[model samples]
Target: MPASTSIARARTDAADRLVAADEPLLGLQLRCGGDLPGVIAIPALREAVGKARMLGLKLARPIIAQDGGDSVTAWVEIDPRDDGCLIEFRHWRAKPLPAEDEGHVARRKLAAERQIAELHARLDARQNVLYAAAETAELAELAARMDAGRGRPWTDFVTIPGSAHQQPLHWRLLDGAPVAVAGSDRPWRATLVPVGLPGAEPAGFELYLGSDFPAPQQAEPSPVAEQIRARMIGREVAPVLRQPIARIIANAETIRSRLAGPLSEEYSGYAADIATAGQHLLALIDDLTDLEVVEADDFTTAPDRIDLAEVARQAAGILGVKSRERGIRIDAPKEGEALPAVAEFRRVLQVLLNLVGNALGYAPEGSQIWIRLEQDGPMARVIVADQGPGLDPAQHDKVFEKFERLGRSGDGGSGLGLYISRRLARAMGGNLTVESAPGQGARFILTVPAADPAGH
Candidate 1:
């Protein structure tokens, strides 16, 4: 057989061992952790060759493989012979992997950790609790204890294994340690990540609590009833689907940002589009899940005394970077301002986030958004106002209706946010209302019962 500079050839035995190969193919085989006369190591090509040989057929396809820090792509034609398979490679190309930004990697890791964490806490430099949140009912008591003991070391509320020192151990020593929490039987692991300059004394810490196993589920129900409950999209399907969709978004982002490797501008733009679409799908899934919950007859909120001003500030902080990216400013309530109200803390935060996030999306670049707090006769109120295209009186009422976008499209909104938000407000004995005229901007106001002055 004659060899051409444009095409590379290789041969495999009946047992799928790479018996021979040309320059780049041979070099790639070894670079991908394969031996000279050993089995194929490139997963996609190996599978294609295996199928071609087994079926005694010829196959052509494009395959991609990673070689060291570069990505290799090629079109390969596999022909099955009597005793082996012949491999021909065409248009082989390799591109060096891109350099990833350290800050981006750190941010991605932090986001992943937060996604899996059941409980989260912010700690001061001395490890005193600044704030805490628990996602599960089982951890409610622990969160409450931490909230009540705000200035105390977080370790005081849980039992750490192997050490009985009176003082909390250094963050490095406590990170990834196992712990036991009160009012819960499941074993848990703790993660403590320091904040501030790389080599300087830490400014604060972020604490995360996770468990290898889920909390025990309720006793088994009748088969028919179980089947019906399992069909609930929110309770049964959403959790299973969220992880894979999130991965799709993350991978698309890596490609769009060229963090994995260098890509042509056209391909990079395609990746950007993919990431945007994935985000839209993820948002729709979330809205559907919330819709199911808020529409259920048994839905209710765990009302508690909460600070509306603090919630407003937290929502603003969460969206601050996004606002800055769009050249918009968020004027949140001052640190000293406090508006106590009786509502579910998490629900209020969710509603406020939706309002602020919507404002950021529609508000003109370089404009300002305001989160203001006020107290009526017996209700505590918070208003999110933005300088965007305002709604007319007719559209104001329709905005909160289910799946109502008011003739808008391509904005990546599901139109379920306001509806779900209104439902949640009503569940908490609160009301969400909008005040706006067609070109004067818009204000979304939420009001809930005020906390009793007597501490009732």
Candidate 2:
């Protein structure tokens, strides 16, 4: 090799070696912090500082705080040949200390290296045997939501319209069941149950009214409409035995309250409501769990339904927690007027989520997003208006287009959410339309007719 080429190769090789060296340090730190990527620098720094501290050596670079104490930054100087970052726990502490063991300095340095090596080996071993728990946390949250539903059909979550090639075919749970799924050709054998099996069963959670999958080739519905409908319900075997669930809560409350007379009949009735509500929520969840699965399918469309007003209320209730989290208000009519729509509840909810989520995200931290339902003789209209920056008339259609960024890409976007949503509404018996000019806020209108049944 020529001199210049050799020098270039040497630089590349040296950089690769530096990156390799950093991996082990970062891995060890991640292990100690229970897989937290943030605290990685801490353990890595201990190794970086070990030799210097043991030999009465000092760092050429000073330690510094970053992000106003949110994180700590430090530099390591080692022959300029090694290029890497160092991590030390001394971030919280203002300064570093050199030890006073001059006589035993060499031995201490050896001991430190041995200790760090052993520790790193142990952490590596654990990492190898175990798994990244973040995935588990996600499942746990899903399970919690499922449990909240209490034996209702669990719909998979989908947000974007796609071939689902981007996602895994299915997700296996720690317990070995395929609890979640996506991008699959085969129908799952087991009805994936969320972890909190018995926990979210508060009351009378019943299964779906029936297993009547819609006809797939019904023009508007997909050619795979029946399959999608089957996919929608998934497997919600049965509701928690409501009487029993209510008994459990009532008994617990009775035990805690020390209320006499074997608890009033009304107390049990109230207990039943919690379980009933839980079951209703789960039924709603079964409707919702499909949010992600459907979103991921490019060909996915909406099923026809009526009662768009009820869906709006249902959506408002579902989003109630999210809105309240950011001090935002999601308004529903105190006395709602019936606005029938031939549409899929889930698809409609998707629009609600987008408009609501967008409103919450773009509007001032504390603002209200309203879902208003209005009815005229043959037509019913549902409006979702956000107090955020209204879209310009030019951008109205563009905003509904897929992958169209409205300055909210950082909000964990597939960007196709709105496009799929609008498509879903149109696929059913309605069209999702937006009305707003630049300076004013935006309003999304979902209009469907009254002739359709309660599919909405």
Candidate 3:
């Protein structure tokens, strides 16, 4: 090369950070007018540095590289030095590669591959499809194996929208299945079974398909609360079960208390146990349904202008009977007191009920539980203070996690109440937090946006 010929250079320490660059590299921005940092901006240069460090020898190669949209051909050399790897570049000139058309085609193919890979990754993560194997079958026969159909292509079993016709073909390439929505608005989860010898490509395939939703006409009813709620809780499952459970509890109560005809002590004790078990089962169902609702991706709260103090009092009232039974007194906000907050009325009540219920469960007998409300700038708050043994600092984070009960089992708690409550509070643009020391009583704080006078 001539003495006056130009070259670009850069250097990086063993940590792969840019430390030095020549004038040519200082002005190189890859694609724009901005200057490049004096660091190792190119992966190829970094690889060369790493290689030089590993071999402890000088290395040189001529390669085609890109600076933004411009392609540059240059000779690069990396030498291991005490400070780090020193890189030298010579004749970094823009040059178009031969067979440009072939390069474009290769790039397009890689992009398509990346798109398909991403789709497969998503489907795999969701457990949307499973792989199976069989000896010989057509698509329709495969469908029959899955109980989809007996003698037709798997495609015929699903009613794919016009834009989704290629979805099934794509699934075949990925060795998986595709989920298609049926005309009834329910989803059909489909899986493909490969028909071939072990470790061999599928000679044929079978299709397995099923509805994603539960069948309403089934002989046994779904015990899930969310599934029941989806069809209107009161109109479907709750009315049927709650009424009977209530009657059973009422009758059990009458027998246990001897309010009806006189009963033997043994039968009365049995009735008491039955009622207790019934109550526990009912509470479990409630917690499970709440769990389902809060965990749903589309779960949301209906925000409204409401009074935090009012909600706190309502929660206290609802738990009053239980509080009295335990000889625990509830101190709620004074009548007509208002703490304006922006949140959903029902959701706020739900969160407060969970918190207070927890407090009532743990608070010392005859101790007072205070439900207080206040307004801070831009925020409204409700503080539930209990005389229960406070939580350790270490347990604060763990308590809000799902299925966490701080080692307390058989307490009729599913460990999901706090988790679900916190989620609901957040959905209403608020948060539920706790403050306590091991010796100090626990204080739970619920905060939400302050309601403005304009009803915003």
Candidate 4:
């Protein structure tokens, strides 16, 4: 067998093998310009192909007719074999003859050619719509799933290989990952491959927001956002405590009634302890819920240009009793021209109460917590400095960490207070920072942009 014949035979056999497997290949290259095979065929397509070949020849390059035929309609595909060449058979059909006449054949050939070309144009158009529709559905599913993931685990970028085809990964600020449902009528390959985020590239592919894998979160939220989320967790927790809180209140009230007249001393002690613990729990709930709601921006703020002195006075008033109970002194700066600062008055007071109250907890009995107002470049500032021992230099930065305690959890604390205060201050366009040294007490500085920041 000649080498050429051997190759042809191998191709013809390979086609037969694939066809045997029930996959009838289609010639669909005329669609979407992507060279897709086996989608649609035109009438007289084989005749038109022969004519197209003839048209490309020059005088010296007259097209040779394949052996024993005036024109070749289909070519055999020679596929590789382990021990020998395999031939694949392919067939194409053409209708209408030119009555075996040269002119008639030419005319038929031309007509067939025109028909094939038109069919190709239409097929290309159809292919575009097929892929486009698939992509549209994918994008829609992606958006819906993203919105639904508002509070679920791990969202953001999806890094799938080959996520984009011939095009650079498209979206600049994609909000959610593209989730896919298997077995859906959607194009998986050559349309969109899942990819990674910017800078996280895989060789031979780019990052896409849609993928078949899950991402592991690399970092935690920012401190401010962390604080917000921590407080907001109260909303998640309130349900669990609602019944318990109600039960406690009810039980306490029943015990206090004592209509049986003079309860036992041991019973009275138990009641008092229960009431104290319950009241403490209630206060914590209120604090957490308020912080959460404020941070969520669901509640309203009443901003006013009021005297800082008055805000301090109110904060001191509320905190003073608590301070006195702890034997701590709170010193408020004397009214100096009633220096006014713009803020959510109530929130400012809340911050003051939290901070001052917190300081008193650590201050030695009879130590002072001082509040003073001063000015720095482009801002008016309030300083809450305590005479109590301050944080260690190693731990100063950690002081604002949620649930971080100086000593123990039972030391009258939840580590969320400073975290919430700092976040709240910043959310209002101000900031709170600290200056401290171990055993030397700490000074917290809260600064805000003044009405005329420079006092100009």
Candidate 5:
């Protein structure tokens, strides 16, 4: 290729470290819009390049490059082959078609049209497994097992009303009509769309599979709208509901304890049950509201330098009464023992309280629950080990899933505690994990980013 005709190129490793660049690529100064370097050096483009390299995929985009007074429209392609990204670029001035190089202009026009069609295909692809025509009707194992069935006949896998072979398959897609596809194990709907060079015969058809689940009758709310609704409910409804609920518990407690006046034994027992039920209701309400808050897109935690040991101690103390009632002892960290971690204090305390409470619930009477703190490199760890009937190996991960209680009955828990605790830990730059085997009891580990002593 001629020097000017050749595409400007560069190479970068998986880490996004610049390994090499051609003379033309480096010589051509690019910018985002102003003085800064544009297409070649922009963070978003580099990130895309890095992703393509890591995922072993091909990525392409059309970008604008300024060449003095001229606005150059450039097509960039990053192909990951072997280990690094092969970045290539082709550009044309953004002006009327050049008469002298009509052939070159035509090719550029075709590429631009292809890009437009590809963009539409991608939008459809978001909800479907996109596939292109090959010599055989094979399916590529992509997007997980969702798109698996390679090297098979199109007619065997898909059922178009009057089509057979790949050519007619492209026709079905080119017709822009819905076509039913045979699922590997069942029947499902799919869409085939023609894709190839513009103004030429399509080389293959783009296949899109219908989702197994039926579409909602009503459109689902957007994340932002969901967040807004969650915030509104959390702000306006929780406090309003909590006030009466709190008073009911308080009044029930007074009646049960007979603090105000003497009460009959039967009445006192009824009052105690009411108080217990009210407390359970209050906890459920709090959990439901917290679930909404955590699932919201805008959920965030306020982070600061907090001692993990102190948080664990405070959480154990808060749940101590219940532990004592159950005859379960909480073994917390000794005084002045600190494990500095970077996290929000209240959130950490809430997570620890949940873990300790869970241990207290499952552990046998007279058994001990240990809350130990330690540090590993950049992470601070709080391990809560219980002497309860241990979890099955399979149940370890499942327990962390939302609303998963592993068939435990009458626990008064909404099954959101572990889920919410894990989310809170992650929001504060940490994670919560469990280690257990049947008959061995369970150990819950909470790890957070350790804080620098100097920063504290």
Candidate 6:
């Protein structure tokens, strides 16, 4: 190879600290904010060195790093030794970073903020809290306080940095301000997005509370605690995995939507595929968490009197847009058509959602879905009927089995929905069953004890 592409040598100590390097490599390291005899600052290089050391292997690969306004690419060979690793930079190239689009930057920033936010709120024009939600127990107290203080400016609940003039600063002023919440030790950032036409007086705002750091983990656990942690999927594992997966989806969406700048159709499609897969993973995680709950020996539901018709309408309404996108229409029970039942309201709603959602997924374009209510003896029932490829009698039972997909692929389903839905129904003193013949569409019926009119 020519001198321009000649190898530049570097070595690290047993501690994995960069101990020595030749000219261009040394200069690049310093430019990347690292010092001689210091830890590798380039993330790609550090990872390669660590892998080589851990496996006691020799490897060659190309790595990219950013230095100021330029992107640096290099081909390096790593050889592990007793002390550390020897790194040979065989190829070195640098190119100026591409110009950034303002709109792209704004969209990326917004997506990132939404992904990291643990708390969210809807506020009126004057910044008064209308609704609030939190994902973790750490913010449960704050969310409760915000809910209780509805109609009051959200600023009353948290302290903003570098602002002492007064409470409830203008929306523009607090759009990206840092804040300190009562229960969280980590500093938080607030994002306020106005809800109105551009350049017009705002109607309301969407508030997101995000932190730069992950939630602090508890001190190291013993063997028993480790076992407990393993079992606490919903409480522990789900929350930890959600943020990163969400961020991955957000970034992929930004790229797929071209909000991050122009890209070839093939690359954009790849991004779309990535976003879809990420969404499937997220759904699977949620399903697994619910599976853990419904399968628990002590699992129970809070039964109450609820209107099956009302719940059916709600499920239809929630999935209205999705159905429309697929050219499917839902014929939900009309208002005032009530079939009162004794069951857990949310659990029943969940079952209906799964049924309706499944119908939407399988139903042919331009097909119709029907959500009807009926009184069967002492039981009240809601049936979700869809015009789709129906299931055989044998398959009907198999469909509700755990993780059963019936040979379908690429549909992004976890195959746990019906299983969990049935478990939820039984836990709520109800039963979920399906009826269909191949090529004749399908109907899913959910039945619960009829509520006593006198008691209701």
Best by TM-score: 1
Model 6 weakest lDDT span, ten residues long? 221-230
Off by over 4 Å in 6: 1-134, 140-182, 185-214, 218-235
TM-score of each: 0.69, 0.43, 0.48, 0.44, 0.49, 0.60
Candidate 2: Cα lDDT at 253: 40
Please give, for residues 1-456, the per-residue lDDT of candidate 1 as tens digits: 122337989999999989999978888778666897999877677888999998888999988766665767789999999888999998888777576667665555455445556678877679988667664445656877887788799999999978897778989999889999976789998988775434767656779987766656445544543433443464457645655665666677777665675444446577778877877887887788779878888888888887888778667766765787799999999768899999987789889999999999889999999999989989999999999999999988899999988787998889999999999999999899999998889999999999986778
RMSD of 2: 21.8
Q: Tell me the tens digit of each residue's lDDT in model 6 across 119-201.
A: 88877678988667665555656877887788799999999978875669888889889999985799898999775434767
Clashes of each: 0, 28, 7, 29, 8, 0
Ranking by TM-score: 1, 6, 5, 3, 4, 2
CA-lDDT, candidates in order: 0.79, 0.42, 0.61, 0.46, 0.60, 0.80
**Higher-lDDT candidate among 1 and 5?**
1
Tens digits of per-residue lDDT for model 4 on 90-125? 452222212234543343332222211100100011
The C-alpha stretches of model 5 lying farther than 4 A from their native spots are: 1-235
Collision pairs in model 3: 18-39, 18-40, 30-67, 30-68, 140-152, 142-206, 142-207
Per-residue CA lDDT of model 2 for 57-125, tens digit only, reads 444443332121123343444322333332222212222223334534332322222211100100010
Candidate ordering by lDDT (highest first): 6, 1, 3, 5, 4, 2
How good is model 6 by TM-score?
A: 0.60
Badly placed stretches (over 4 Å) of model 4 are 1-261, 294-302, 335-337, 452-456
Query: Residue-wise lDDT of candidate 3 within 1-456, one digit each (tens)?
Result: 112246677776767556777765555433223323444545455566778888899999865544433455568888888778877888667643232345333333322222112111111111222222111111222322323222233454445543455334644443334455332344544444343333644434434443324323334433332233453333355334533554455556655554454333445578778766766666665676677667778888767677787677667765765787799999988767888888876688789989999999889899999998878889899999998889999988889999898888777788989998899888888899999888678999999999996775
- Tell me how candidate 3 scores on lDDT: 0.61
- Name the lDDT of candidate 6: 0.80
* Higher-lDDT candidate of 4 and 5: 5
